[model samples]
Target chain A: MSGRTDTINELVRTPPTSFVDSLARARVRDRLVDGVAASVGDLPSGALVEVTLASIRRARSHPEALGQSEEPFAWKPVFVRRSLGLAAVRSCAEGRFALPSAAVGPVADQAVEEWERTGQRTFHWEPWFAGLGVGGRAVVLAEAAAWATSLWAAFDWTTLNSQVRIGGMDDLWTCPAPRTVRLKGRSEVRTRLDMVVDGRRIAGSDGGPSALVSVSGGVPSEGWREDLAYLALVAGLRAPDRPVPARVVGLWPDAAEERTVEIDEAALDGAVDRVVATVAMTAAAARSTSDDRPGCTSDSGTLVGSAAA
Target chain B: MAGPVAGPVAGPVAGHVAGPGTSGSTPWSASWQPLAGAALLERLRVTGRPRPAADPVLSSDLRSFLESGLCEVLVEAAGSGLVVTQGRLTRALTCRAHRMDDQSAEHEFTIPLATSALIDVLFRQLVTTGSIDDPMADALDGLSLDAHRAPLVDWMHGLAQAERRELRSEVERQADGLRQRWPALDPSWLPRTQTPLRAVLAGGQIDLSVYVDLVIGRPAADVASVAFVDVRSGARRPGHRDDRHLGALVEALRAPAPPFAVATYYTKTGELDVDPVDSDLLVAAARRCLAGIRAMDSLGRGEEPEGTGSESCTMCAMGLSGEPTPATASIGAISNVAEAILHVAEARVVAPSTQTYAQGQAA
Candidate 1:
């Protein structure tokens, strides 16, 4: 659907149903939990290590580096665009669909007001945004508008499944392997499942499987499947009681590329292996550094690393 | 982005649409009084009629015509297709010799953060936010977002305070002119900035790429509805009237219909030159495009290209000094001033030749 000129409607109309049953999902979760625990068993207690897709990619690219160098992250326009664009898209989805150019400033203002009223520093965005002058803020709005416009144009919203969710809580999995390791996967859209049992629809059934959509920036890579698998693994571990996503679609609008990965037991196993490797890398990085391990702050203020990879 | 697929409409000519004067305040601004954005929109709305939908047959025919012309040129040169961007097209059309040298040049030069580049970035902000505060600071912050410009940013940071102040003043003045002339666009207009357009012709032998500064209106409407605007910071130059290239490219890129109108907004003078799109414009643009491709091919084969020796080519590397004879002093003065400012700023960033630039400024 990326560059084929076909609308996204076709992709979601007759989605392939999930074949992995309740027992299989539970088994996958148990395997992931055990794999993660075993990977970080030797790490000292209370040593918090953050693991994310970016850290995994970094570790893979720089295998020779003993420890990951810590750099204080600043809010660049690109990062701000993604953050504010997500909010604008959410606004469009909830109220009315307007061009991103018009929605970004108002949504940004609303965010600032919300922060001012609550005085809760959930994320660093509010303080950073408040500090910017009008010129800097205008730049943020312009960048975000372009970002949101690309996303809004990528799909025909009126034709998609009715239960589409945009920019909510991303899939998160926190593991207490005696070292308090956290894993995160950022998803842009999720189509909630609509299932009926005995001629009656279930509100939120544990067996139902939703579809996750990740709108990425760069071109799709060879590790796209693994990337989606990691998200599935996090989703599974986050809610071990519920079934994982049925499918994960990664959309790269700039490159006009899209790839879909179906979640199953084998896919979850691959994801578990990826998590074990990431944990091992993080533990090594932690050992190499004498200073305290620094938790990576993502765009959404997650304690784990960024999902930008 | 292509508009929705609709029925084909008959090609209609939009005549002499005028609006409140967006005349330039400069001495040379007297001749060009383009319509403001509001006036252009008003003219389109008042004169627009319910036309037919997008005609697939017409689009296909146009594509075939373009391919045939491009292929004829390719066969003559016996060369494979190469990428031809809008800049290359403009360069080739202005002076084929300059275009040829530019293509073959091995030296990589950095473009200083001049007023033109600053306006280009700030235009996006204006379209999105409908206003601007400090154009200088905003443009710097915007450029910093691009990782590839780290070297340029470093160079900018190392500039003297006085030089930085001069650049900032120029940027602020140009940005102010832009804001005064530019109108606030509605969201329903669906104004998108820096929309990429590509048209592959002759079985991918010729890849034409261009980015429309701003695009509005929904595609695939009952009639031609979309509009394309190209933002310019420098004085209006020759070949700026050929917006038909943009229209031709958009149509060739699978747009259900050609844009209703194409415009060029000069930030220096707050002039918005709008031209309605007609079949003739697209045809002319296609013809010009073919000529450009043939010229590029000729240059590739080491064949000599003709030089216009126009003031636009005064800086041509082919020794086309474009000296200003007494008969063309007025026109030459405008071009010389703009060129001198740009060339000097570029030199300041790439080299240490500030004395000449300072002398030019004093004169």
Candidate 2:
């Protein structure tokens, strides 16, 4: 047991954490701000917001109350100037499209969905007529929440460890003010899920990580209603320490009539695995191309074998 | 008097996981104290070897059949390495098996654990959740499974049945043709003489019995001695750089007290003579094989034992291609020296502006 613990301990300390400098953090910030600016643009006018708010609040005079947070932070932009920055992000990252692109698409797609409709411009609205009922504002709120969450998510993506923000109404739309990247690496041999369950103590209830399930109060619906639940299930159950036999099944289409234990479990396991693996592979490919890993700290650069590539 | 055969006595436990609970690998909960060395796999190989004549006819025919240009080759780019066209090999074998009249057996495309972990993770996830909306379904269509299975499964099954029936009918159809055309022939040579393998537990019961022995036997050569050449891509490279791994493999092959032998098997293009490994290779490979392993040991330096990285840098397990990209820094490139410099600079930048000016004047 001691030997095993020792082995585990070594895995913890041995790997290099980074090869790039704070410059990496700076690069990440630049890409993110650029991505956002390209997709969506500046905030909405107070008059426009006031009108939309008034229309929705007619049923209830205090318009700020409906699912809308009274908390001041909730007042920030949703589909406006923030989306342009995301658009910029999408373009810059478009070239290395495969790396963690899956993660990016959810955020961008949601923002795009908000941009195309703009709540004020939905089929339900006549820019002249009350601009997309409360539902439209709901969309804006959802989009804003999503953008904010994604910015936070970017912190996960960037090298800048300091506090960061994604979308603010004024001055810098998505500012981490680029300087340098100093990123951290993931752990080795934490492959097993008990670490998720017990060791790493990732505080998720039986339902699973709320972060995985929730974008915020809002679901990134365009990317939502998709198989994120399925993905969450997979990530939750993935056998880290060793391989496990798995099956992803649904009630077979024909089973609808006699919903009683209709035994048909199609193979979805390998498909999901491919998606996760592709993300890792793509990132490894980028680092390999730059031959830049050589400059990063050993822990952060890559797994011993991955760096070789 | 004897023990299990000198091979992976357990062949993936017939669709079982390689962890505890059932037939999978060591469970995560169970502290992984992988047996002291290759010593375990090696010792097991020796005491449990299956008996055979000293000089059995080396199945060179199997080798020639596998490597021969009798089938078409296919290749795909995999993230870890080039995915060689094993399709030709599989097809050639299937055809040969049909011609020889052995239709019931099945062969699956096998991938090493390290290379296939991503798939394993997804599969595990699928098992847990049981449903994938259009998003996952679209991503899955791009893999070898869909590509290979879609166009081939039905075609091969049809060919198998047709070939068997056609061969059988040819004999009856040409009793006259057989006599004159095949006077020197055994007469039965033209007929399909295969005993198609099939098993049935009941009308709808699950029956999974096989006649062939499918054991895992590593190549006899040391990791250093062998070369992993992509036969289709013509991408050939030595299997290992360090010789210590090779020495471990050798020790396993020639375990005198334990008694092991190099076991050989034939694949489409070549024959692999493998032996049970000794204690050394496992330890050495374990230390270095992280890079090759899928999605594991990256943060902790897959090869090194004591390393840590951040959760942000972790590649998304979900398969969303359109999701917002993580920062380049999130991919992890900051060095310790860089970190120190960054901290100092931050200190310089954050320190009182007046203090900085005074220090500059004194210097």
Candidate 3:
């Protein structure tokens, strides 16, 4: 089989151990931080930019499309399946083997309770979920259950390292740029190698070089390498003091397939280019809107306004 | 060689029950997959859950026996061979002449008169998210999202207002029935909808394919844990009992063991007929399968298919006429083209049909 196929087979069949990058951790983070700073230098002050793998890909492929106004995000069955599925996975990762069908409703209720306690109606999911009729709620449960089953079936949970991180807020990286910019890399599965000291492998509880594992839909695209590398970059940026992830593993469960991208200098640079291109496109889109209507706070009103708000 | 005609097949097995009153006191082990959702099925509940007598060793032996027998049948058949689906098996057993007609006919995309497919789509949505606002609108939107259903969706949109109203009412009635019967299934049951099973034989030339509407519970328990539920939007048919049987056989071939129970939930009448799976059911289903494959092979060889003078003969494409002939029905109908056509036309006029022939096809 080809090397690419071999990498995916190894990834699916065995616990990941061989793909660890040999690059120095500190040097790589410095290079990535510098790249981020240079990329967003031209954006206006107090502009909030959130770069996700989706955003970077869209920026590369459909830059002009970004400038056009977007419809506000709605709560579709397809949209929240992953979010609710991840909650079930969190429970599973913590040794509670509950199916998505059983866990999603309770977790959603918990989220609404939390939202109610804080009196935060900033996001409409809690209210929308709370207000749905029995059938509508059941539809949400069905969609999420299917999503969770896919994730659950993809990995043999018993075989993974006990410290595997499922999903949470820790994956977000707030880039230390002049403007308010954040790169979010919400991975489905995260595993760290045992920390080694003096050439002997040490089973440290934490603080070891890790790998980011994510699940994507359908097949891998041409920008898959950059997409995974962007996640690795965000993970590194999120914890600069710790070691950078050696690699990023992407699994497409629908096809029973996977792709691995080693997070070396080239992959990180590609990710940086995509992020820079994304910001540039957003700025151009904002400027074009401003030119069309002759200025009414277009800088803040464009991409940043909707994202930040 | 004489082909096994439809009427000679054995009568319905004794294991199935039409409605509720099943014992529900089975204590579940820790590793056992839970069927908390099945427990709520008041109408479809079976008497004391039937545990599989076959252990893993016995299950493996049964699979090998079925596979070898099925493989032998396929090896004896001619040409590149056929993919045996659940629909084909049901048809082949109920009426061989009709099955042959379907096999010989060319497929055409026509506007559906029946609302079962729409009801099915809506029912699936209900399964996923236990609520629906407008059945007609949700079904349309759901159909629109599917690339394959674009043509059907467009056709529905172009339908006359009267037809649309009729269709919506039919769908709404069924949707109500579905909601009334189907309980809020516990997520712990790990209810999976539209689960497909395929078992290949004769080097992938012959595929036994079945798409179960809903499969509850996981396999790998001490007792049989998985339960298969088939949703039906129309009135229940005698042949419908074979659905879960066929599903169980195919699942047994693939999984470590067969599912514990199989149910058919009729959405039009709110009737749920359930049966427990056992070695006898699987063996009987296998015998029927072999007979169907033999009939299919006979058709493949260009031999004329025999007609059974049963009640469904009125709707039969063969248009066979005359009284029920238990002994000679296979050769009873020798109608010429014009007579056959006239008989079919008269049957259509005489039959007080609630649904159009096309609508029945959708079901």
Best-performing candidate as measured by DockQ: 1
Q: Candidate 1 or 2, higher DockQ? A: 1
Docking quality of model 2: it rates as incorrect
| Superposed Cα RMSD, model 1 | 12.8
Please give, for residues B105-139, the per-residue lDDT of candidate 2 as tens digits. 23432122111221221222221122222212211
lDDT of 2 at A57: 18
What tens digits encode model 3's per-residue C-alpha lDDT throughout B153-230?
777788799888878888887777666656776555557776656665454456677877887654432445567888
Q: What is the DockQ of candidate 2?
A: 0.01
lDDT of 1 by residue, B1-363 (tens): 332211222232234433222212223435644445655444433222222235444455556655654554657644455777776665654453454465675234323335666777788888888777778888877666666766666777776888777777878888876677677777766677876655656655666666778877655423465667788777665466554354444453455566656777777666656554545455456555655565566566676433233433423423554342222221222223333432342333311222232231232
- TM-score of chain A considered alone, across all candidate predictions: 0.82, 0.20, 0.79
Q: Order of candidates by lDDT, top first?
A: 1, 3, 2
Residues A1-309 of candidate 1 have per-residue lDDT tens digits of: 222324443443334456567788778767766776876665555555566766666655554452645457777777787778887877776665566777888888878888899987533487788887665677677778877876776666655535677777766677756556788877877775555568766443335667777877644544678877777778777876766787787776534456788888887777777777777776655554434543432223233322343
Q: At residue B316, give the lDDT of candidate 3.
A: 38
DockQ of each: 0.17, 0.01, 0.09
TM-score of each: 0.64, 0.20, 0.53
Native-to-model Cα distance after best TM-score fit, residue A98 in candidate 3, in Å: 3.2
